[model samples]
Target: MLRYLFLTVTTLAIVGCSNEQPQALGTLEWDRINARAIASEAIVEIYAAEGDQLEKGQQILKLDTLLQQAKVAQLEANVSVAQWQLEKLRAGYRTERVTAAEAALNAATSDRVTKDRTYQRQLELRAKNLNSQNDVDSADNRYQSSVANEKKASEELHALRAGYRTEEIEQAQAQLTAADAALRYGKLLLSRYIVTAERAGRLDSLPFKLGDKPPTSAIISTLLAGDTPWARVYLPEPWLSQVAIGDEVSIKIDGRETTLNGRIRYIASQASFTPYYAMAEDNRARLSYIAEIDLLDSDAQTLPVGIPLQMVKP
Candidate 1:
């Protein structure tokens, strides 16, 4: 009976200790941000170097923009021309142009009248045998030519006063719309030439120096974020089952005297072998769930990544 009582007490103690123990163990880590080249262009200048601290949206590098600038300029010119054409179509012919066309028609009409009167005189002379048939024929040809000229001039005046055709106006409008869209696209392409940091962080690595033309697939630089570092830990199955996300815990940085408080931010749904940092003889063969702890105190910022830390479950 004494033996049975001792076993029951020991079982209770083991269960109680398991409840208070940390669920996972891992090293501190920070999220890395990468500045990648999004355009295929030659690098013109690098405003930043490795280890440079940068704010969000800061210019990290600039690609050669001469070609892009030229393209945009050309597109702008096209847009201007299209706009002028559309405006001219909408406004119709100018008053001065209409007046000129009318004057041309009137001059042609007067010439036609003079030619017709001369041809009639030649016909009367031919009938009296005072003029040869060849003279009548020449006058007749001149009259006919002048009549064609008058008709041509009259058509020109009619066209000038009638304004642009509906189809022509619509075509001009479409051209203007197309030109505007092309200009916008050219400007958008130019914007990609200036490479900017997507987040506030330290410039971790720059693969290319100034004047280097790197491939578009190459990462321009990697950024170590400025946020507080979090602990990346792996918990054995036993501890994994005991801890929940948002639970408060104590983190003691290895070789540090102070302990930091933090909350569990993540718990892996799948289990894997214990990572190298967390491996020990006792847990070497164990499957552990990965977990993350967000340090609550400012001390986390002072700590570097890969540092060992101990977490105590509260």
Candidate 2:
């Protein structure tokens, strides 16, 4: 009992003497968007550069859109033409198409009547033995062929007067759909001429200026990271019991006192081996839980990335 009591007292004394204060740390940076791909037309304007501040949705560039404007007008005309054609089909084939078919049928019928009269005369001649059997057969075949031609021409007229068949209309409608999609795609390409600032931040590493051409998918610039700089600090076993998220703590920065509001964003469920960077005499053979904290900063521009920071706990 005496040995156990001594061990308990020593552990409590060690815990009571431990310090939980903010360690001076460096700043952090935010990730960047690699936006590229400008309009292939003439480069019109470039509005941003390195170290320049930007607001959300601010226009950053422009390109010549003369050809694209003309193309948009042309697409509109095509839409009108397609709609007119569809209307004509819906109203049935035009009178002119039907008229042409009727004319052809009349010609066929006239030819058939003439051939039939010739066949009748040839039959009479064969009966009287004045004509050969081959002559009568030839006349009969010509009359039959003329009759078939007349039937074909009549059927053609019927089809034309019936308007577009369902299948034909469907095909035309499909073509219209394809044309609409193409026009939309062309407009999208046209809009790519202008790029904008998506977030509010300082810019860095901007490469292009007015009239400079950049390649597709190139990283020309970055929004220098700021706003409540964050750090992933490791929590050792000694302070495990004393810490939780959202605990208010005081930190020292460049000899100035600063307070940070921390919330436990995440906690690892299981810990394996300790990382190499966390190795030391007191920290050796120990595993740690990571805590992400947002540090407060007054100047938006001064915070750089990858700064060491210490977290304080109440």
Candidate 3:
């Protein structure tokens, strides 16, 4: 009979052991979230309104560049001129230009020769008493004038053959460089006028309108990055020891439980003031340590930021 009583007790004990439950040390409720505003070098011309969904690299603002556009046009024209100059310098003057200059030089040379002959004839006539001294002097002046004309024409021909001067090419090249930079600056300014979504996310505000000047360093707009959103949890001093980095925890939201892989990414070494909204029902003005629970890829987008959560602390 004693053996039967012992067997019955053993069976009941085994049943009780089978029904035993696991206990959680504590729980972390709610995720803390803050708004992140977009910033850039461009003037914020909002193409999309507050709450507008945006894709990455979409242009939302533009800067004024009429002056720069004109500058670009002027530079293009100068480039054509520079190209012509470079080509002319490399190939020498065109055949037609050189031919015309050569013709002028030849005409001048012929005139000089004819005048010299006339002067010589006049002098001989004077010596033979067949011409006046005034006539000889006039022929001599005419010959001198023709000689000067020939020299001038020869110099012009040489200049034409030289193409553009070294200094002129250098100056044009400099202008081209400056004009390029100016156009780039204008385009940059145009970029400044327009703002774009740097990352794919939700736009939160349009504080500054299309023409309104937004205060520098002030919140013009906000964006909440969709992918990789994390739930920040504040663990109490007593419960923190149970939760460490890389510990798996179970989180329940709206009665649906999901395993949130917690990476002890951030542990506030020093305790900070508890976020006002994080006021626990049992604790007031609690000094708490902050930790981040990374959401799983499937639940990342659906996880509500600052949602009151129940984390079954291990």
Candidate 4:
């Protein structure tokens, strides 16, 4: 009876210890970054191959930029034209144009004086019966037309001397500004044809071959980004309260003899169905919360993703 009691007590104690430190099972993962095509352009050149390490701003591949370059050139020309127009408006009329307008006013004034003198002589002749009524009417019409022409010429000269209106200058300036903005946008769009790494990472894939044209927004490259892989584990519902973000834990890999250190970076707020790898006979029916633990050791950087690992409770 004494031996039976000792064996039973030992078995219970072992079971209690196992329940206190349940292992959370999961796979290693790295943050993935996908570079997408901005346009349906043929891949002309590839600077980096798959499995190569890339730094931020490093060229990965080049797409056909002929079309985009042409567009940018057109925009640049438009900007130049707009700039010239604005400058012309701001500078007002040229010296030669002002001189012509002044000359026109003077000629109109001289013609009006001649017409006035002719009309007065016709009126005096009609009053003395030397000229007919028709002659006086014709003379009056000529004089009035000349006066209108002179007034028009004077206004034209005045306008030339007054320079451009405030509204006209502002409109020209706005056109130039719009053209410049369009040019800047075109240049930016052109740069997108050359694929470059936005972050330092390992180039995991090149989805398109050289000379292949990809659809717009299609994935052109995939990168495994981050300095180290993180442990993506599922915590059993029962143990969810025991662990929290910022808590340090031990990471055990399948073939690695030494364990790695990790910190809990995130834990899902809701519970989910237990994944196959994390499901055990006792916890098969229980839901689990997804958690991500960032590997703290620099050596973990070399670890491949999707390798099964266990999170040992601290």
Best by the TM-score measure: 4
Clashing pairs in 3: 42-192, 43-192, 61-194, 61-195, 62-193, 62-194, 63-190, 63-193
- lDDT assessment of candidate 1: 0.84
Q: How would you encode candidate 4's per-residue C-alpha lDDT over 1-314 as one tens digit per residue?
A: 99999999999976875575445899999889998998999999999999999999999999999999999999999999999998998889999999999999999999999999999999999889998999999999999999999999999999999999999999989999999999999999899989999899999999899999999999999989998999899887777778889999999998899999999999999988878767655556668899999999999988887899998865
Q: In candidate 4, which residue ranges exceed 4 Å CA deviation?
A: 1-23, 272-276, 280-287
For each candidate, the alpha-carbon lDDT, in order, equals 0.84, 0.68, 0.64, 0.91
lDDT of 2 by residue, 251-286 (tens): 433333554444555545555444555444344466
TM-scores, each model vs. reference: 0.64, 0.67, 0.51, 0.85
Q: Is candidate 1 or candidate 4 better by TM-score?
A: 4
Residue 35, model 4: lDDT of 87
lDDT of 3 by residue, 1-314 (tens): 99999999999987775564322222332332222222233342456766666797765554344555575677667666666655556566788988999999999999999999999999999999998999999999999999999999999999988877888767766766765676566556444444567677766555555555444455555666655566566666767777777766665554455555544456668877666555543344657777666655465465544456545666
In order of TM-score, best first, we have 4, 2, 1, 3
* Arranged by lDDT, best first: 4, 1, 2, 3
Pick out the ten consecutive residues of candidate 1 with the lowest summed lDDT: 17-26
Model 2 worst lDDT window (10 residues):
20-29
Q: For all candidates, what are the clash counts? A: 3, 8, 8, 0
Runs in model 3 with CA error above 4 Å? 1-49, 59-103, 122-145, 215-219, 230-260, 264-314
